[model samples]
Target: MRTVGLALVLASLMAGNAMAQPKWAIVVHGGAGVIARAHLTPEQEAAYRAAMTRVIQAGGEVLAGGGSALDAIETAIGLLEDDPLFNSGRGAVFTAEGRNELDASIMDGATLKAGAVAGVTRTRHPISLARAVMEKSPHVMLMGAGADTFSHETGLEQVEPAYFYTERRWRSLEQFLTQNNLPIPARPEGAAAPDAAAGLAHDEGKYGTVGVVALDQAGHVAAGTSTGGTTGKRWGRVGDSPIIGAGNYASDASCAVSATGTGEYFIRLTVAREVCALVEHRGLSLQAAADEVIQQKLTALGGDGGVIAVAPDGQMAWSYNTSGMYRARLADGEPLSVGIYKDEP
Candidate 1:
């Protein structure tokens, strides 16, 4: 009888301790797509690793210094947005019409508060605008010229169209248009041709990337996403990056997710929310949920790429079906770190 009573007491004590333990972490992704081995040269790989390290360090510092999860997530994602290689901010791909249209979103898990901006031009930082819309306005999302107006009204820097122009993006647009028959009108009607018809081949050489989900010392969760819209996209196409449950989503009582891959398919799957659902509904582990959605479901559905996820308990997972993904993480004891390409992990 005494033994049974002692066992019950110990079990209750263990549960209480587990509940009291601090749980916090951050995971991030560069955009994801058809990442192939041949595409990454050694020098490029090294550069990616170095960039990941810097951002991870910056975000981890915020968390370690007792900053809010929002601050940490914003800090980390900003670094990736600045890197030209990832196709989010400066390196954003060109539209079919040879212009830059960017999208971004951020979610605060604690309050289930969220904000997003889509198809914005001239706004220097899409994420900043998204954050502003979340706190300053009653709206959850804004698009196109309207988004730019809000940014200007709120005192966010507005760049001219020239600020977003990049030769690389221009070339990418030209290549896509050329394949569709150069000198053709800027608009291509209907859907893009299949892989064979339009010569729509996946160029593994240029993979897209986004960044950061952080759980800070106070156990709050935050997630953010930013992306240059797709390369050679027509019809003013907007992607999942600006969609809350597709590219990014978070909840204080559950988890946070940052998604990468073919934006269209991700939107179809509602990939970010699916991760949280797996945990809350199915009671699966965080890593298990990520693998199921990013690796199994997304892959089975013919979507390529990956995601970064963090449970409220601070369990972190990064999973992808591509040849590689740009990712890095920081835990309780580890110092700042970085990872580029696929091979480093």
Candidate 2:
């Protein structure tokens, strides 16, 4: 009888310890750039906060219910992509040709498997297509019409190009054109100036990408990123969002990262991979690695943007050099939180 009682006590203690440990965590970002709190009206701030809350809750529920990190991250980014407030999916910025060209990528940390799509025009959810590429196709990346065709072959929903149109985005594109003294008419084939297309100003903090990083109950890490590329981008330009290791990276040994900001800079720096490398090679903590990469390295390179990262142990961290980043986080036993300005808590 005493032996049986001792066994019961040990079992109970083990159960308690498991219950006390955090099961999962998720972090997401809309975009990152020169966002200032004073520039936003109170109503606008409230709306952004509400949207962040909704996204975190939706994704958090999946993590809490024992969903894979891949599912949670994809679910979170898909919500941001569908919302017109962010620079992805329905709200993607217009290219130099006055059209939307989207890019997206997804990564699984356990297996280091990744998939990406670039310059896809009609996919309703580019992130889903990214996953499809990862799972259904053998390729790690697909682009332009090829990606759209693969998306169709995989049975992902397709939307008309008109579905991406938004008055706000059109206005932003017009403003960019006016600032550069470029006419509203489309440039002739092979005549577009690379500088005119590449250097156009972006909306505040809307360098126009959305991303998510999640740690699941099973201890797997996953990340995803989606964007409409740059405003006034030409010649089928693809951004870091669709480039694994630049915009998205994950590793069960280190962390999962999703980035938003200037695609060119991110690509040059390989921002996501740098963070993971720091953690794996230098033994830096996830927070320290993320900060070094986002605040120090990227800043030194004149890159402005940020990243959301989650570690296998449920630690979460985000860092940006820009004035603000649209970000949110949820973890076991913690309150859901969202922020848009540099000074926000």
In order, what is each prediction's RMSD in angstroms? 6.4, 5.9
Tens-digit lDDT track for model 2 on 76-170?
Answer: 88988888878889778888778889999999999999999999988999999999999998899999999999988888999878777766677
Can you give the lDDT of residue 185 in candidate 1? Answer: 38
For model 1, residues 193-294, the per-residue Cα lDDT tens digits are 221101212244434758588888888888899988787777878778889999899987678998877888889999999998998889999899999998
Q: What lDDT score belongs to each candidate, Candidate 1 first?
A: 0.77, 0.86
Model 2 TM-score is 0.89
| Shift in Å, residue 302, candidate 1 | 1.4
TM-score of each: 0.87, 0.89
| Runs with alpha carbons beyond 4 Å of true place in candidate 1 | 1-23, 182-207, 335-337, 341-344
Q: Candidate 1: minimum summed lDDT over ten consecutive residues — where?
A: 193-202
Q: Model 1 shows how many backbone clashes? A: 7
